[model samples]
Target: MAEGGIVRVRHCGAAIFCRRAPARCPACGSPLRGAGLPAAPVRLPGPFRHGHRQPRALLLRPAAGTFLGGYDGRSDLHVGVSSSQGVVYNYDEEGVHRAETGWEQCISIPLVQPDMFGLLQQWDKLLEEFSAGEDWLPHRYDEHDHNCYTYALAFVNSVLTAQGKQQMSKSEFTERFVIPRTKQASRYLTLHQELTAKDFYIVPLPDGENQG
Candidate 1:
């Protein structure tokens, strides 16, 4: 199992990850099952570490101010991909940029486990060639219909094709991968804000919220 990774439990349809695992399921209070009884939860890395350490990752950052700067309690994000060299490739109003800086404030979602796709050596080259393609031209950028998310998704699909895997549509990818991770980020942000503003944060739950 990956260190501090997320776990999905089918027994109670619970997806929970934390620093320490409780003896019983936090949701249903059942004995934790699986190879790792106390499976570690994902610990979201600080931006500085994530940018320098996580290569071949899908990265997200607040589109405007810092994540905590959100007034409406939601994040509007910009998406990018990390090259094998740890440089970030993202599309925006200025077109695709190969960036070494400015990614120190992003979240990382791994595109694959280390060396899983057998393309680590060619990752940077592929990103460069793809970003230079006419489809991602600066003039073609659009905020809503075609934007950073589209650019990142396109690159991901290109890699999937090369890996001989079925390519995912935007909706499919967003629903399965992006949504779950983003939801986790949102929860983290909310709790952080609450704790920062007070001695402790008490999350008010709906009745039976933890019943599973």
Candidate 2:
């Protein structure tokens, strides 16, 4: 085993990478470090390379009541526009806000990566339209009509249309992608028994004091 390096713990013939050299394995919580110990390979960061970086669209789900909680279980959607360097734009209610903590889950949308400059220009144009009190920015937010879900749908469709791709509606996107992804993530935890494991834990907050 290498110091401060990745390690794997084997239990029931199954093994998983151990983030740290815990006193017991994270998988089975057994004190068997050398039982299935194997040499870990060294990984080093590489220099940045120039290319047409993929543009990402992340759907962020925050805790309930973080924004207006009505339609879906999730509160709001934050679109993260990223490149090779890192996240360039984290579009939210504050309008092109910087990426920060607070999101509970992030669902990525599948779309062809467009030119970085072109994408930036498109976002800039959208911001201009928003500032001009255009149709892009709904006058008010309604649960069933206008809300964060609608805003995200509009933003994504705008980018897709600008890239000559077919547009999608909020319902279609939610049913086909968002809902299914959320279910999958939920199932993963249950399948792994993370909710009942002795070592599994989550700090609880006082009632009425929770924030997204």
Candidate 3:
């Protein structure tokens, strides 16, 4: 009989086929060998590797609002860095300032942990440098051009470029990063509005007081 072909035994009246070499027959206890069985399956490794580390947290907060008696709809942009402790740095009509944490919307971007602390330190140093200028002044709000959104774009791009990452332009940052991630109520506001509008600036909470 051919290898792995079924064989009928007259004595036990049973059919037997051996899939592996030297296998015992099920009905008669006789040894048999077969050569036509399929090979075993191979197991591939899993998608995720063991002991893989997760990326560090880098939070981006984008906020929008209308200042008192400015407009009916939200029409301003503010960006915040959560890497700093207990405060968000933003630029407004009053120029660059730090406020207690209450960003209207936030988006977390993963960054290399090793560089996070250094980047934050650089951010603080930049602010200090601006403060030390002989002609130090807050960024003035321009109706059709320079505004909060412009400040955010410049600040974020500066940090990104310093870290050897790709720098984003004002339009690119707004459309790709800020608009897509911001809340719906404030998402549609653009920098090129024909009518001028104002944005409500955040006030620092008193010491040891929490924002409600």
The number of the candidate with the highest TM-score is 1
- List residue ranges in candidate 1 displaced over 4 A: 1-49, 69-72, 204-212
For candidate 1, which ten residues in a row score worst on lDDT?
1-10
What are the per-residue Cα lDDT tens digits for candidate 3 across 174-206? 686545445432322221121123221122344
* Residue 167 shift from truth in candidate 3, angstroms: 2.6
lDDT of 2: 0.44
On lDDT, the leading prediction is 1
| Model 3 weakest 10-residue run by lDDT | 45-54
Lowest lDDT sum, 10 consecutive residues, model 2, at 43-52
Q: Spell out the clash pairs found in candidate 1.
A: none
Per-residue lDDT of model 2, residues 58-165, tens digit only: 444443432212224334444443333333344333444334343323444534345566665556455335434444333454556655556556766777777798
lDDT of 2 at 33: 43
Residues 69-137, model 1: lDDT tens digits: 542445478788998878889999999988887776566888877656568777888889999999999
State model 1's lDDT.
0.69
How high a TM-score does candidate 2 get? 0.47
